[model samples]
Target: MAERVAGILLAAGSGSRLGQPKALVELGGETLAQRGVALLQDGGADPVILVTGAVPVTIPEALAVHNPDWSTGMGSSLATGLHALAETDAEAAVVALADQPLVGAEAVRRLIAAYAGGASVAVAAYDGKPRNPVLIARGHWPAVIELATGDTGARAFLRARPGLVTQVECGDTGSPDDVDTAEDLARVRGVATVRSEEKS
Candidate 1:
């Protein structure tokens, strides 16, 4: 039987450092939120959920859930997303961050494939370090939400259960760098430009 996996996009952050909503930030002509949804869909995540806060964003392709406690931190957004997922038929979820526009579908697909291969927890690793776009089986959602607090998200929970995690090396598939500052955004834009030039 095929496992039903969903995509949970955390885009509720206020982006205080960038002085704007990161979800609205544009990369290669697409908003960060839009890019996130596309990546998840293209990567094979069915029924993508976008947890929004800080600022309102409407993406036709995603089921946007507003996190009223978003100001609290990434944990709140993650909790909100997980809570929303509980009502669905998803057996697992691939969590992605909106700021990480550089994380492509290939990385997400790898995580999903890992989860499909009996891995309870799957994470993308770049240069031996685990990064965003983690896959969490439904059985671990409760523990993950319990440990998810402040900006920690699922790090604490994943750390506590390192033995269950399967790391998918995706260094060549995508970059985990997030756009948290103006300089970072510029760098992403530069990369986008280079990519566009190559495609042209």
Candidate 2:
């Protein structure tokens, strides 16, 4: 049986940099949070969690629950999502970011596959540096809960224990283009447009 995987879309950032809720930003006919949810669902995750805060807003149907404590920091939201994931039949959890509206569905799938293949934590590594859209196996959930903080997800935990971390090099630039500032959003839109044209 394929182990069930949970996906946590960390969309609770205050968006101080962009001066707006990043999750609500529109991209390719959908909101950033919506895109994150879609990517997780397409990646085979069940009970995807949308961690929210700042200005509370409506979430998509696929999103399991929202964390109100998002103001406290990313750790609070991570803990909230982890607690909810513990209730579901998920064998592992993937922590994604709503600001990263361009993380491809295939990249998420690769992370999950690597996690299922016995990796404690499989993260998308782009340009020789690992980034979010991280998949955490059940064995590493504790660490995720421990190090998740202030818009910084599980990276600290992974870095603190390098031996247990698995880097899944996905040839994707979208993973690094997280929309934090107005300029970032514009850049991502340009990139998305270019990619869309290529596909056509």
Candidate 3:
């Protein structure tokens, strides 16, 4: 059967460092959560899932799943998303971060393309450096969940099984800069302004 790649947006974080929830952060007119859903959908992922925690977020065309244990960190949200996707017919999932508004849909498409090209685990790479928008086949969901502790997400599992992962180059496609601190958000929002202007 062909792989059906879904999307998981980790928006559960309260963004304590940024003084609010990252998911609700506005960038160029849209909330991070809204942009996230569009990013995945535009990249061809169907039934994108947004894992919510610190605050409730409702994104259009996205399935919001509350993670009660979100206070633990991104790992739980990552596990929660995979567990939710397990109930669906999707054979794989492309995990993206809500705070990473700079990452484009092209990255997601490339990850899905990698999965279709025989990669069970793929991470979008920027200038040869592995980053977010990681794709993991359903077969490895259990391992990812088990190793996804703290804020590391699936880093432990990926590091432990390096041979099983594939890095898809996506540097030219978009940036992986995350909106973590106030300065970070301001910087990205400035870039966002430039991007919007260019489109006009």
The TM-scores of all predictions, comma-separated, are: 0.98, 0.92, 0.98
* Poorly placed runs, candidate 3 (over 4 Å): none
**What lDDT is obtained when candidate 1 is compared to the true structure?**
0.93
Candidate achieving higher lDDT, 1 or 3: 3
- Alpha-carbon deviation at 180 in model 2, angstroms: 1.1
lDDT of 2 at 11: 81
Query: What is every candidate's alpha-carbon RMSD to the true fold?
Result: 0.8, 1.7, 0.9
lDDT of 3: 0.94
> Residues 27-136, candidate 3, lDDT per residue (tens digit)?
98899999999999999898799999999998769999999999998999999999999999999999999999999999999999999999999999999999989999
Worst 10 residues of 2 by lDDT: 56-65
lDDT of 1 at 73: 94
